[model samples]
Every structure is written in C-alpha cells, then in structure tokens.
Target: MSRRRSKILVVSALAVLLLAWEGAVVLTGAQASWPFPSGIIRSGFAITADGTLLVALAGSLQRVITGFLVGALVGIPTGIAMGLLPWVNLAMRPVTESLRSIAPIAWIPLAILWLGVQGNAALFVVAYAAVFPFILNAAQAARAVDRNHLRAARALGAGPGLILRAVVVPSTLPTIFTAARIALAIAWSSIIAAELALGVKIESGGRSVAGLGQLMVATLYVKRDVNALVFGMLVIGLVSFLIDAVLRRLRDTLLPWARR
Candidate 1:
C-alpha cells in the first residue's frame, strides 16, 4: 500500500480506538479515575500552557542524549578493539556477554547507591542500556570488513592509519548508525524507568526529579490526577515515535546505500 494510504488507515484505527475508549469510560462511569480521550486532550493543553510538559521533556531529553553519547563513545572503541584484535575479543567477550545479560533496570539500585538519587544515577542507567547494542553491532560490522579491501589498501602502500580512515570507518558507519538508533531507543526507555524509580524512592522524602516519568508518577500517585497521567503517557509515546522517525530519516539520508 502507499505511504499516504497506510497513514490514513493508522489514523482511522487510532480514532476508532480512542472513541471506543472514551465511550467505555463514560458508559462504565469510570471517567473520574480512568479519564476519557477528551479529558486527556484538555490536560495536554493545560500542561503545555503551564510549561510543565516542556520542562519535564527537557530534563528527560538532556539525560538521554548525554548518556547515549557517553555510551557510544566508549562502546564503539571497545567494540572496534574486540573486532580487530583476537586477544581483545577473547578477554572481553566473556565479560560483555555476562554483563549484557543483566537488564539495565536491574542496575538501578546499584546506580542509585553509587551515584545517589541525582541525575547522574539516571545517566548511569541510560548509558548502561545504550552501550551493549553499540558494542555488539560495531563488532559485527568491523569483523565483516573485507580482508581483500584491506589487502588492496596495504598493497597500495597505505599505512594502518590510512587504511583505517579510508576503509574501515566507511564500511563500519552504516552498522554504527544502526546501532545508534537502537541504543538511543533503549537509552530513552532506560531514562524513563530510572527517573520513575528515582521519583518514587526520593519523593517520599520531599525530593523529586524532573522527567516525564516523574510527572506521570506525581500525577498518578500524589496529585491523583488521571488526566495528567494519561497526558504524560501520550506525550511519551509521541516523543518516542518522533525520535525513531528522525533517526530513520537520518539513516536513510546519510547512508542511502545501506537502505534495504
């Protein structure tokens, strides 16, 4: 089907679902706690007008970007080393495999213990969530680099640095970008989970973190505002969709040859 047609179908489906949800809530007399689509829309407007949503979004984005960058910076080099060097792979594979088996959410308690309830704790979780995808994908990409290409470059009197710059990097970039897109999604999710955990753990002591997750938690638990909670959930879904769309467009534009 055409893209336009697919989008129309999706929009129609969403509208039907929303209408069903609104009707169910109204008919069941659960509007007070569950809220209808209309109430959530009004909450979105109120939060946007008051700047609450923007502030929470800014904090979440800041942590996600910073932590993802850190993860990519470290993971790419480590992955390259593992791919290029037999000894490095032998030494690190076991450790990486073991660590990556553990979920990022599982690290939240240790992160909080080591870094406290500050933004740094959330950053640690996001970075942890982001790093494994880069390492795994980059290693696969680097190892798949054609030996004939390297040999040809060497025969042409290219040094290790020259061949790496001219051959290795270009060949690896598509996979690196793919890894980046995956890691970023993981990082975004990790930040939200970390922030929500932090908010619950710390807010009881009269301290709070600023994030969409925190906002959701506050609205649901403390303020008992179902509309705001639903609004925050919708904002999270929209932001995630936008981020993925932007990354997919960037990948298609910059690495057109990699497109399937």
Candidate 2:
C-alpha cells in the first residue's frame, strides 16, 4: 500500500478502537472501572494542571538521561577498545558475556539493597539496561570495519588516530546509533520498573518520588482509578514514540549515505 493509504488505515484503525472501547464502557455501565478515551484525556489534563504529571515526568526523565549517558560513556569506549585490541577482547569478552546473559531487571533487588529505595537504585538499573547493547553492537561494528580500508590508510602514512577518525569511527557509527536506539528503549523501560519497584515515599501529594510507573501502579491497584491509569499509560507511550521518532530522524540526517 501507498504511504498515505497506510497512514489513513492506521488512523482509521485507531479511531475504531477508541470507539469500540467507549461503546463497551457505555454498554457495561462501567465508566468508573474502565476508562473511556475521553476519561483518559480529562485525567491527563487534570494531572497536568495540578503539576503531578510534570513532576513525575521530570524525575523519570532526569534518571533516564543520567543513566543513559553514564552507560554510553562507559560502554562505547570499552567496546571500541575490545574491538580494536585482541588482548582487550580476550580479557573482557568472557566477563561481558556472562553478565549480559543476565537480565537487567534481575539486578533490581540488588540495586535496591545496595542503594536503597532512592533515585540511585533506579539509576543503577537504567544504566545496567542501557550498557550491554552498546557494548555488543559497538564491539561488533568496530571489528567489522574493512581490514582493507585500515591497510590502505596505514599504507598512505595515516596514523592510528587518523585512520580511526576517518574510517573506523565513521564505519561503526551506524551500528552504534542502532544500538543507541535499542539502549534508549531499554533504559526508558528500566527506569519505569525501577521507579515502580523502589519509589520513595513523599509526604506531599503533588510532589512525589513517584514516576509514571508508580503513578500507574497506584492509580490502578491503590486508587482504582482507571482513568488515571490510562492517562499514565498514554503518556508513557507518547513519550517513547516521540523519542524513537527523534532518534530515527537523527540517524537519517547524520547518515544520509545510509539511504543509498
């Protein structure tokens, strides 16, 4: 199908889904138990106006950003080193392989035990989630750089630094960015889990240590507020979608030759 037709179809499907949901809610007379699409909108607006949503979003974003940066800073360089040096690869691969096989969420208990229920616990989890993909992808990408390109650059009297900048780094960038996209999603999801699992209690109603995940959990299980739960879920989905869209655009812009 054509792009325009595909988009229309998607929109149509969404509209149908929304309508079906509202119809079900009306038929069941369970507006309080299940949120209609309008309930989600109203809840979102109400929470935003009260500044509850903003605070949670900001706290979550801060942890995710910090964790992602730390993970990338550590993982990318280590991966490059491992890829470029046989000794480094031999030394690091076994440890990395062992650790990578373990799920990031599995470390949540340890993180909470080590760092307590505060922000640091969540940060640790998010960083752990973000690191492995970066390491694996960057190492593979760096290793996959054409040997002939390196030899040619060396033959032309190019230094290691020069060859790395001109050839190795450029060749590896696409894979790195791809890994980054995956890592970002992982980091985002991990932060939510961390926040829900280890969220600190705040005395203030509006100003809480709770992130969206916490809000979602509380709304559903504690408050039994389906509208609020739906709102939180929508916000999460929208933010994730936007971030992924931005990353895709950045990739396309930076790697224009990738299109060919």
Q: Best candidate per TM-score, number?
A: 1
Tens digits of lDDT, candidate 1, 1-260: 99999999999999999899999998999978887889888888998999888998999999999999999999998998888778999999999999999999899888989998877889999999999999999899889999899899999999989988999899999999999999998998889999998889766777664887887777777878788887788788888889999999999999999987
**Which ten residues in a row are the worst by lDDT in model 1?**
201-210
User: What's the CA error at residue 39 for candidate 1, in Å?
Assistant: 0.8
Cα-based lDDT at residue 144, candidate 1: 94
Candidate 2 worst ten-residue window by lDDT: 199-208
* Tens-digit lDDT track of model 2 for 1-260: 99999999999999999999989998999997778988888888988999988888988898899999988998998998888889999999999999988888788888878986667888999999899999999999989989999899999999989988999989999999998999999899889877776543322234344577666656655577788887888888888898899999998999976543
* Candidate achieving the largest lDDT: 1
Clashing pairs in 1: none
**Model 2 residue 162 lDDT?**
100
* Alpha-carbon RMSD, each predicted model: 2.2, 2.9
